[model samples]
Target: MTTNHLELSGRILRSRRFDSPAGIHHTVLQLEHKSLKTEANMQRQVYCVIQVILSGERFERLTDKLKAGVDIQVSGFIALQQSRNGQSRLVLHAENVELKN
Candidate 1:
C-alpha cells in the first residue's frame, strides 16, 4: 500500500476545535517548525509552517490542553486541503500527538 506519512515536531502556533456536519469532533492546529540544515557544507536555518488536524476521540481529549506555543510531536498522513478557491495546500491529518517538554 502506498503511504503518505509525515511526522513533525514543533511548537503550536494556533489550535481550535470545531464539529463537522457528521457530528465528528475535529481540532485544527498550526505548527511552526524550525531547524538547522546543512547544505553544501553550510548550516542554514530552515523554517516551515503547516496545518494539522486531530479528529475524533483524540480531539475531545486534547482540545483543552492544546494551545499556542506548546511543543509537541505529531505523526500522521499528508493530504490535500480541500478548498473552494482552487488554492489547496498540503495538510497533515494527525493520528497521534506526543506532548513535549
Candidate 2:
C-alpha cells in the first residue's frame, strides 16, 4: 500500500529458493548492512532483502552467481513481518537488488 519505502544495501547472509505458481523462479538474499541517507550516510547498520529473479534462460545465472560475503545494493519497501509466535520483524521487498562496492 505504500510506495514510500527506503532503500538499503548490504551483503547476503541467507539465500532461499523463491518460486511462483506460474513456473517463475527467484532467489532471496539476506543482506548484512545498509546506508540510510539521501546524500551518503555510512553510519546506518541495517539489513535488507535482496531478490534476484530469473526470466527466460536466466534461471540459473544469478542463482549461483551471488553468495554469502558478497556485497549488494537493494531498493524496496520495508514492512513489519509478523511471525506465528506474535513477534514482529522489519523486512524488505527489494525491487532493485544488485552487486556493488
The candidate maximizing TM-score is 1
What overall lDDT, based on C-alpha atoms, would model 2 receive against the true structure? Answer: 0.63
- Give the Cα error of residue 101 in candidate 2, in Å: 4.3
User: Tell me, what's the RMSD of every candidate?
Assistant: 1.3, 5.0
Per-model lDDT? 0.91, 0.63
The candidate that wins on lDDT is 1
- RMSD to native, candidate 1: 1.3
How many angstroms is residue 80 displaced in model 1 relative to the true structure, after the best TM-score fit?
0.7
Q: Write the per-residue lDDT of candidate 1 for residues 1-101, one digit (tens) a residue.
A: 89788998999999988899999999999999999999999999999999999989755867788899999999999988868988989999998898899
Clashing pairs in 2: none
- Quote the positional error of residue 20 for candidate 1 in Å: 0.3
Residue 73 of candidate 1: its Cα lDDT?
96
